[model samples]
Target: MTERIRHDGIVVVGAGLAGLTAALAAAPARVLVLTEAPLNAGCSSAWAQGGMAAALSPDDAPELHAADTVAAGAGLVNAAMARLLAEEGPAAVRALADLGAPFDRTESGAFAQSLEAAHGKARVARVKGDQAGRAIMEAVSVAVLAAPHVQVRTGAKLTGLLQEESGRIRGVLALIDGRPVEITARAVVLATGGVGGLYAITTTPAELKGEGLGLAALAGARIADPEFVQFHPTAIDIARDPAPLATEALRGEGAVLVNADGERFMDRYHPAGELAPRDVVARAIHAEREAGRGAFLDAREAAGKHFPDEFPTVFAACLSGGVDPRKQPIPVTPACHYHMGGIATDADGATSLPGLFAAGECASTGVHGANRLASNSLLEAAVFGARAGRAAATQNDAKGPFTAVTAAELPPVALQALREAMSRDAGVIRDAAGLTRLLDLIDALEAAHGRSAPLVAARLVAACALARRESRGGHFRADFPGRAEPVRTVVTLPALERPGLRFAAE
Candidate 1:
């Protein structure tokens, strides 16, 4: 039995930074926000500890920011997209301020800046060291509630996308309080976050298992760069299911990466050592743990005395876990943090299918390329989220000949086993045999349980990683540890097949 609910306004899914920003920006037009969690609870935007990146300092500029962004992208970055993010980032930060976001300021009343890896200058705008994400979301949530044009409904889980026969997306099918309902709208924006939850050791919210990316692809949208999953180098390893992050700002402040014996080890892996690119640092930490050396982030000498004042979040996390940063080095490991690829979108957040726009971690706009520059995720969400909002508001697709859609069922599989498989075979490092084994498991799961969203999303990543045969960015291949031609991997549901991979069923 299916129930239809018609909404004449733009429908935005996932009430994170992007969705909230879009709802506020789509002024004069009615907006409906459907979220799986209250406000920012399950959204990655609220989990971000590092501040947004922008060329706000007197010594920095957009070109410098774009240059560093290109360098970190490892050859696949689109120069134009990178330039746009750098150019619009400053104004976006100021706009957040106008919305009452309390950004930290220097003694001179200018926005304070801090340096991160791969950046040439000090230009990350923060708030109370690591409270930037929480502060910004608090301000944005207040604004969303006050906006007369927006209506928010929390705890709505998306199941499918509604698309007309003419390739125009109408709205979505969701489960609200466990009852299936179809909500049709003039336009739909997928701002759902990343696939970090697919791995057992992750820094993202556990429920973000690439639902938006999978649902969009199932509806025939093009997926881009699905293989590139960036692992943050230093997640606090205290046996927590979803690990707490040790922000990269600690490295920027001169913290060292050492082993169980307190010997600094990053220098042997890269010339830049602690300040190396994220992929390099993650790989180094992975290597250390693999060799039975154990790994820790020694922030005692760097931000120890200033712990509470400089990084209250990390301080509190450590204190709760019974580790004192001022006295001892914190145990750390590489954990799945962000996905650099998702449903492919253009500059204005338009997907290949009409009337569907995307922003934030769910959309791959080619700005992050092979690897993301540190602290750029928040900026991308705000700048592009607003753009997608305005574009969706003017959509005339409301006149569409809408189609009847059936909701996809959750696949029955061993969830814990699947996550352990991904972490063992697909985390930090990879090889052909491991990826092939992963695909074989996926093939059997799909064959027996039908195509589930989480399985489809995981298969998209593993299959693409197998096809990409060389090491690049976060998708490292131990068998082919080198770079190839810089072509981005783009695919649809039908195109993501592994004809060459073979494995015996368990």
Candidate 2:
């Protein structure tokens, strides 16, 4: 059934940290926020365990943070943007603290920080060791609910963008439960998280399968770096699909990665050993598993007595899976965790299409170039989410109304096939043959499903992976073992329709 819409000052989709932060930033100006699931249930933000990183400690500085970010990004981060976010990261953490996030503190009542892999300092500010995501999301959720100007609509899924005759985004078409509704807003922000749900063995919620990227693409926005998907090395592999994550913070606190033979294996992979960057760790874990060495995180030496308080999430997940963290090594396997590429955005979170901004994992903010640093995802959400909100709130317009088109749904079997194809072909490892087969499979799926929103996103990732021939970050290619000349893969839907599916170099 068709329901007409009401306009708001801003519309923010996906009520994770980014969407809620945007809503809070736009406050006093009426805002509407939508979430596909209950606020705490589906978002990757709540699933995050490692904590937010900021140069808050006495020994650390923003410059150090920027340098680490640049190092992790592999020379692709925008210098100005990285500097701005890193310099301001402490304040962002403070703002969240002011909003009542219960961060762990030192004995002196100062903010406590932990060291994560790839960082040179103890800059990660966590909550109860591993409850950072849950605690922070809960705090923000309370703030959003209490905000007088922010109205949150739960169980509302954004299906597509509504545009003006001039091609500016007007608002969104959403499905609330089974009923379809169109809501017009002066501005729309997409914060629908990452593309991990597209894979078979992922840590992200099954429902969040790059729908925002798909919707944005179908609405004609430019996409960037669609090939790079980060796999976390320590997803507990107890015969579970969409495995549980054992946060890297455990190792940061001194846990070691070992093979079945009780050998410390990370030393052979990188100089950083247990503290290498995530991509390196994930690749190491993948290689170990592929070689039948059997890998696990042995946190017992460090976290035996502190498991419950330090890492409630990991402790409980392990308990449920019949592995006791205090006595046993948690079985681990690499699983898709984050996507470095997404709806392309400028530093201010503005997409190619005006009036639509994206933050969090849904937008490729370029802060995370080839891969994301351990806890930087949450930082990017708050900093850029606020930026996007402030930028969008200042720009308001009155547009004429028009009829809205409805969103299409994919069949059950087709959806399963798409997931299986992504998990098998476009997963952690890539090769020319696999990626090419993935593209062709996507083509066949689209021929049947008419390039439905999800399939469009899947195809974009595969096509981009097929084009980028070199192994870098989360995208490792056996065919192209070395890093070739680094160039960002940028694609526009119109450009893809050209012969050979080639994107013109800018």
Candidate 3:
């Protein structure tokens, strides 16, 4: 028999930055936070190296930040959403600092900022160089643990969404201590990070296989931009699962990309060289690796002796991989870094389904249109997370008969197969043939393992990627090499029932 519990408050799934932020903001109203792993583990927020992006510098303005965000999104960005994120970003960063994030400060006591890929101005507020995510999450975790109205429950893995017959989500079905536990609440907030684990090589926690997104889709929630996924160009090329990252700050500080022969290669790819948009740089590195020249990030001249103090995280990762950044050019590769698409939501994190909300990388709020601006992810998480929390606090429990929606679990072997297929086909560069093969694999896996969450998420990415025939942003197609009309792909499971059916383009 399954255990059932009722909580007269909001249920927040995930324990990352967004989840904790939402929990903190939903104060006075009781909040039950659930996580598959212990706090600060199995979360991408803690692994993030790049700091949050905001217009905190005197020379920078919110307008400029918004403009850069739109430019990086490559024509599909929602202008209003970008502007809203930019306008609210500064305060969000300052708020985290107030919570004891310990952001690097200038001699005059102002927040020190760094220049990343597409930003025209230096505006990324960091912590001890590349320790932004860890430090910020530490501070937020402390606050959430101390908050009176918040109750955190670890070792609870979300398995399904409990929704009313009217499609109103009322709670979640989770697996706790190897038993099925149903927890019903007034509102459910999904901040379950990204789909990086669906790929073989990623810069995110391997446990983040997009179960939240898949369960949401199965529960009839709308999904947006399912084809756009960002691949960071400089994930350290050690043979590590969920690859370690070499933050873009190194490039900002004058690092360069080079081939195996010690030849600089970025100049041949883009005018910005080491600082090109993520998509461009990823493609460049991919092309180099495919050509057998090999790709590397030459940061010897950039940090050199200051490597230990400036980038301790990266320095440790390199050392573990038997490569010293001070003496050797770090081998690099493109890996799944962030998902630019997910359960579609509005500016306030409210999804189409009533009583349900999403934030963080798992929710596509249109701030990141096709490709995300560098370092903007953390900012979006903090900004929209609080918004979602505040909004969910006002929701009252629905009184109606509801059905529990659950999915089968994909076996480890099948999941590994799926991950390999995703990395090979729907990865940095995609085309029709590869995408079709990927879909076929997903179909086979589903036929054998039932409609598992990972398979559903993988199908969403492949099907939508196959439907969209243009090369733009992170989704580059070799067959359709040029950009066509700019349109956002919006989908639901019902609409994807028919093969070759193009999703509703917004």
TM-score, cand. 1: 0.97
lDDT of each: 0.88, 0.86, 0.94
Error of 1 at 485 (Å): 0.7
Tell me model 1's lDDT, rounded to 2 decimals.
0.88
Give candidate 3 regions above 4 Å deviation.
none
Candidate 2 lDDT over residue span 1-506, tens digit each = 76867776989999989889999998678899999799888998998899999999888999999989988987566667788889989999999999889999999988999999899999999999988898999999999899999988887988778886656888889888768888888889999999887888899887878888988887788999888899998999887766889998999989999999988899999999989989899889888988999899999988998899889889999999999989989899989899989999987789998889999999998888887888999999999999888887876765775444333566778878878788778887888788778778777877776767777788888877877778888888888888877677788766665668655323
- 2 or 3, greater by TM-score: 3
Top lDDT model: 3
lDDT of 1 by residue, 1-506 (tens): 66788888899998889989999999888999999799869988998998999999888999999999999999888899999999999999999999999999978989988889899998899888888999999999999999999999887888888888987899998888788789988899999999987888999898888888888888888999988999999999988878989998999999999999999999999999999999999999999998999999999989978998999999988888899999999999999999999999998889989989999999999999889999999999999999999999998746657764443455435556667778878889999899889988878776766777878789888988888878998889999998888889888877765455432211
Per-model TM-score on C-alpha atoms? 0.97, 0.97, 0.99
Residue range 433-463, candidate 3, lDDT tens digits: 9998998899899999899888888888988
Off by over 4 Å in 2: 400-407, 504-506
Number of backbone collisions per candidate, in order?
0, 0, 0
